[model samples]
Target: MPDQPVDQTTPRRGSRLSVDDWLEAATQILVDDGIDALKISRLSARLGVTKGSFYWHFTDIGALKSALAEHCRQSQATAASRIEALASLPPVERVEAMARLLSDPRRWAMESALRRWAVTDESIAASVDQLDCRIFAIAISAMRELGFSETEAHARATTLLYAGIGYVHAHGRLNEATVDDLHVIIEILTRR
Candidate 1:
């Protein structure tokens, strides 16, 4: 039999979308639009699934919203883990990875949306703040591991993280050549 054409608008028969699919779609919508646009009807239309499908996965829109917040928390945890894992690599490699994270404009879209939502939602603002503090702590610890004094570690970590935050807020990203230039600076920092 010849392969059947797949419809992009809807899922195949007997196919079921998982919770991750729903959550990912919701997060994308949250990023592309805003919290106000995160309604059940809108999400259903966006996902090209029925409203009943949403209820099968979530009790209500409020449930989905709560799940979305938790999903964001989980994402933050994953990012923190990635940052911590960078410690295993050499200093130049580590710095390059950090630069990639900062310079990738698409990397921080979800967090950017969260920040916009945070302006009105105090709870979300707190979550964003908590993530910031956690990243800063990880950064400072990484710097200390590199043999910097306490104050110096704090300063380098601050510079690294603030560069990322500033890019996210300013919607800027660095090119590969600039990132390559950063390696020379990292080489300087890591020399004993």
Candidate 2:
């Protein structure tokens, strides 16, 4: 017998999409259509499944939004962990890695979307604020590893993070010129 092509339009009677799948679809919708488009019906249509599948994964719309926020928080934590693990590398190299990570287009889109969402939601605003602090702490620690005093490292980390955020907001995508400019900025910021 030959294998049949799976039909995405209709899921099997007893099978359903995972929570991750729904989240990914919601993220995509959030990125492309903004928070207003992140409703369960829209996500179900995007995923080619039914609203029942979403309910199976999430108790309600609020639960889904909380899950999405948690996902973003986890992603930031993972990035911070990776940056911390790069302590063995030169401080300049570590700063460059962090710059590249911040400049990533996908991350920028998700961040921009979340920032937009945060404006109207206090919970999301709190999460964003916390994530920003964690990122700054990681950057400051990396600068300290490069022999910078605590105060100087804090100032430098603040400068680097602000510059990166400004660049991301001003130009969501990086070009060669931006990459070269980033290298220069990292060099200056990490200079001991």
Candidate 3:
């Protein structure tokens, strides 16, 4: 007898996708199609696994959502750490560096999608709120180094934070011209 070709359509009793695999797929689905697309059935089909595989990792959709929240938090922390590394630089350079990094389209899309989802989802909203504070703290610190008073820095940081996020979402690109315009905006906001 010869070895048989395994039938991929059949769900093997012990075969299953790992938690990381699930998270990756879930993240892609969310990024591509939004939170509504994260159904277990869809994920099983997408991953070539059975619903049992998903169930093995998560007890329910809520459990999966909780995992997703944690993943988002981790991602935000990673990005913030990268931004925080610029603290050693002068204020203007720090702000410019952060702006340029964030202005890329792909990065903008990821952040925007997560933010839009958070707008309606309470769980995501809470996670985003925490992320927002971390982002604000860095921006304010940079503004203060640029000669703005504490109150002025906070106000300017908050304004620019909203503007940068909105610009990426609305314009989809922060090219040289856009970045130049943003610099003007920053100047206006930080002016005493």
TM-score, each model? 0.73, 0.76, 0.76
Clashes of each: 0, 0, 0
Global lDDT of each model?
0.74, 0.77, 0.76
Weakest ten-residue segment in model 3 by summed lDDT: 168-177
Rank all candidate structures by their lDDT, best first, as comma-separated numbers. 2, 3, 1
- List, residue by residue over 8-85, the lDDT tens digit for candidate 2: 654454566778877787788888878887898888777776778787888999899888878866866676676567
Arrange candidates by TM-score, descending: 2, 3, 1
Q: CA shift at 109, candidate 3, in angstroms? A: 2.2
Estimate the lDDT of model 1. Answer: 0.74
> 1-192 in candidate 1: lDDT tens per residue?
999787675555357888887888789888988888898888777677778888999999988888888888777677767767776766556766766764665666777888888888777788878767766776676678788999888888787678667657666354433555556655655455
Candidate 3 deviant stretches above 4 angstroms: 1-16, 171-192
As a whole number from 0 to 100, the lDDT of residue 116 in candidate 1 is 87
